[model samples]
Target: MKFLKQFGIILGVSFIGEVLKYFIPLPIPASIYGLVIMLLLLSVKIVSVEQVKDTGSYLIEIMPVMFIPAAVGLITMWSELKSLWFPLCVITVVTTVIVMAAAGRVTQFIIRMEKRQKE
Candidate 1:
């Protein structure tokens, strides 16, 4: 019953996100809106961590299973992807390096800020 309630809360938030996404003109996905709403709710203590922790943890544990369909879809399109594989790989590697560099810079900035605060 507790799990059901937690799951219901999540789904309710997601449904609100979907409604917002439908009305808004932005290109953002419903899931992103749902996540932001969930974060805000959790941050404000409107939704306690204890309320959702168990179900959230369970969802996280099974997250990889969620990607299986996407993997299979990609595999089904392999022939089309094969022609662009080289360029796709190059783009993936380049973007990954760029993201890593950006993340490192952000981390360093945050660390510096923390150090300044401590002094």
Candidate 2:
């Protein structure tokens, strides 16, 4: 029952994301919109972490299983991917590094802000 409620809330937020994506001119994906909405809601105390924690944790635990289909698709496209492997690898590495750096900087900034607030 609790899982169902949490899952429903998540789905409702995702539905709003889909609606926004349909009406908006931006190129961002619906899933990203949904994530941003979820974050905003949590930040504003409109949604408590405790409400979604169980379901969210469960989904994370099963996330690898969700990648199986994508992995299989990649394997099936091995020949095509091989031809584009160099560019694909370069893009992946570049994006990964950029994201890591951005996340690290954001984390450091947030920690510094929190420490300053405490003092």
C-alpha-based local distance difference test score of model 1: 0.97
lDDT of 1 by residue, 20-119 (tens): 9999989999999999999999999999999999999999999999999999999999999999999999999999999999999999999999999999
Question: Against the true structure, what is each candidate's TM-score?
Answer: 0.88, 0.93
lDDT of each: 0.97, 0.97
Model 1 RMSD in angstroms = 1.6
Each model's backbone clash number: 0, 0
The CA lDDT at 38 in model 1 is: 97
